[model samples]
Target chain A: MNELVGLSIGSIRQRLVDCQLSTVELVDAYLSHISSQDRALGSFLHVDADGARAAARALDQRIQSGDDLPRLAGTVVAVKDNITVKGLPATAGSRILAGYDPPYDATVVARLRAAGVIIIGKTNLDEFAMGASTEQSAWHPTKNPRDPERVPGGSSGGSAAAVAAGMCTVALGSDTGGSIRQPAAFCGLVGVRPTYGSVSRYGLIAMASSMDVIGPLARSVADARQVLAAIAGYDPDDATTLPHVNLSARAGQTSLTGRRVGVPKEYVAGITDQEVRDSLSATVDRLGAAGAEVIEVSLPTTALAVPTYYVITPAEASSNLARYDGLRFGQPSDRTHGHGAASARLRGQLFGREPKRRITIGTFTLSAGYADRYYHAAQRVRTLIRQDFARVFDQVDLLLTPVAPTPAFPLGSVADPLAMYQQDIFLAAVSLAGLPAAAIPVPTSGQLPVGAQLIGRSGDDNLLLDVAEGLEQALPVSP
Target chain B: MSDTTPTVEHLTKLANLELPTDEQAALAAEFRRIIDFVDALRSAEVGEAQPTSQVTELENVYRADTVEPSVHARTLVETAPHQQGTYFRAPAVFGGQP
Candidate 1:
């Protein structure tokens, strides 16, 4: 409990401001920790010690100057590899972009740096944020900090593991269908998947453009909020971003009293884990006791989220990933032994199996003759799923459900792809609805951490965080 | 008729991936399994629900064709593995042309 590594991001910033520690000292400590610890955990694709230290020094000077520093001043944060940091290798955890560097920092990265947030380094992820676990990362699989044998959850697996292992104060993760929250669940961290476009997508390599949302994974809900506050808001480059609003409630102001919380009956219907269901039920009861009115609601199309998302996401991904044709970024191989064919061979050898596989699946799904049969049909179903959530929201201010059907399953048990896809069932619907949801670690209730997902109305990001703070206090932190 | 047996090869080509025989077989099986699992959606009844392309009601936004600043060529080519006069060069690929 006295561990600074495991302390909340808010506390870490306070310590720095109180002159108890310097940003450079914090970076040095974490760099030493990463150098010693990251090999076993496989968290970062690259740990930029020199860059981080330089930034830390600059931040230290700012703190010393006693200028108006953002609340997250001197906090260490890790960025998912997909989000570009100028001069850093933006690999998106794929060999296709093994050492690609962007000319400019992603808007969010620039914002964090402006706020005096020290970017520790780039964390590993699914190849193009495509897989269910970091096992699919091009270079290495990020192991669960809790238990190395099990996955940290993905495609933001490394970011979650970084926070869980006390490697960073906060980490930025993108959720396109539970990528952020699921890993947070696995690693016992607070993961918030803000409403789509709440955070700028200007620098993030596109996975599913529509569903991709940037959020924070941290040691506590408050820590997540601090990082979110720094990064959340609009960038003119990303037209989807909402203008930044000062959300007071996100700092744990709003009460649960009279807040209509809905328990979607269909969510827990097929889930076999009695304990997971009981935990969610108990969360609802806890909220009710916290003075919020909890009601039972049904979303019949909830089960269809994964299917619809898989279709729609791959369609967009196919187009987005097409830019990596070996001409602009990454290593370009000889393409004309006889023609442009030889370079294709060289390029083919450079990318790993997963990146190649996803690009192919996306292409095939969006191809002629199959486009309507697959992508269009999925969109129609996505409509029903969206309407289902909208209908529920009309009756309730927030919806409660399990972040996942069960706690972290053993890593290797999900060998079957369909079973792995099924795991995102509870999450894809919220992504489809483009709603803000917070997954706060309810407790280790048992072996692994389980989180009760609080999905709020569109743009209700502040309210979602408020509910998360309430849940954080109501729920026991077994970690 | 598209044969599912070629799904692996097609996907590999489409994704610009070279899969070993073992991985090819694995991907084929996995793709088939997922496609089969979600195939049930095709049979579902949709009364009058129109195909929804995007969930958010926002319009497709665009800037007024304004010229934004771009990086200098030096910075752009800073990370390139090979560079020649005002261009990035690599191992030659063309046999007849080059």
Candidate 2:
């Protein structure tokens, strides 16, 4: 509905460069949109309009004075609250951290700011980026812009909501399981969950340390591409970051000719959701029309994805979230009886119902008696999932699958926890494999924004984005 | 996977929450349903697979443990709901009065 909101980030950058749109003006426009519509949409938990305007004005001055401007000068971005932004609240959507402030910027935030992007404020999320829907947020749930009553799938729902509602041109969100891609699919945006090692994890409030990856969710694939290009690359602060790779935007030379896309039989079989299956099938056809080849391939271990992901993520999350014992950072008094009593109190009060449940399950699974039965078994299954992807990559440039079992379910609709876990079936495999996955919406199907997932080879992050961008253009966004 | 004796104290300790007796039956049923769902991995054959703690190959990258200049301690502590001097304050765990 918003023409400017739908503009690709690269094009917007060019418009600003050509003086057609000033940094300050664009920031103000976005601020006006947020003020007008964000309440209903629940897009942002914190909106720093004045701060972003000040930064945007400074960038405008630099450009006006003919200074060498940063790559994303004055482009406004909405940040997930899990990420630290100096002087802004980094709540992670938990009551324990409702007002917790970080003294410094997250490594990614620092990089985005260095690129001259104006960070408007923090978006809502699942408490500590834990749940699939923003419904888990302590603040408010972000509704899907396409259908306001349905959830904008999360834990990055607010990020997707903000982008879809034209509150921010691009936003950052972390994906552990389907956090980024699910929300992106639900909201009809380009959600990129990059190769695990591609982006740094420094200063992101840890959920599952191994599985968490921060990526861009935006209105268009190109906008997602631009945002990824800016904050991706390596950070010395994060041990897991892969060395930087050079990405060239050979504009208009986008040709998918000879790019082989594999349709994994295991991914498609047994899917009962007609709308989701049809959307993926249609997307495959669209990819072919966009000059790509498609073939049916098998990833037999696909069934193990959710099991492996739940095991490994909970195990890792138990370790990652162990830091929030109400002592050093959060509600400090809860754990302050001294030593062991302190840890007990801190752990109980600071961590909410969901976090405690997960940590409990994880610790039990990893306990000495059960490690062989659960934790080690899950690890072995993870290798099988990766091997399945590896074998498929040998046959095709990309592997296509339905991003989830269904389109966005209604907020609070899932009553069973297992059903909630079932939603991550398509997502968990790529995460376990440590490969790249891009979620591009299928235009037909009334634009429920069902994502047709593409899995790229281990380090080929750019190729997936290119394929997504190409498919996006071939099939215009619907609904 | 075996239900022998209910290690009520031990399991409660692992669960971290102080649960009252009335809620235990409900929580147990819920946990059993979850475990049964995840047990689907048993049928998945992963004989030759490697144990993947992390997906990619990354060794620890460490920098010197020098204390770099950080934001003001007072300002960082200021956001906590309850603060005394430099520390955060929260409710007592269980029934232990402090």
lDDT for each residue of candidate 1 in A246-315, tens digit (9 for 90 to 100): 5441465557888899988888786788668777777877888889999999998876777777778877
- Worst lDDT run of 10 residues, candidate 1 chain A, spans A335-344
Clashing pairs in 1: A334-A343, A335-A343, A336-A339, A336-B93, A336-B94, A360-B15
lDDT of 2: 0.79
Q: What is the TM-score of candidate 2? A: 0.92
Question: What is the CAPRI rating of model 1's predicted complex?
Answer: acceptable
* Residue-level error in angstroms, candidate 2, position B90: 11
Structural similarity to truth (TM-score) of each candidate: 0.93, 0.92
Q: Recovered native contacts in candidate 1, as a fraction?
A: 0.40
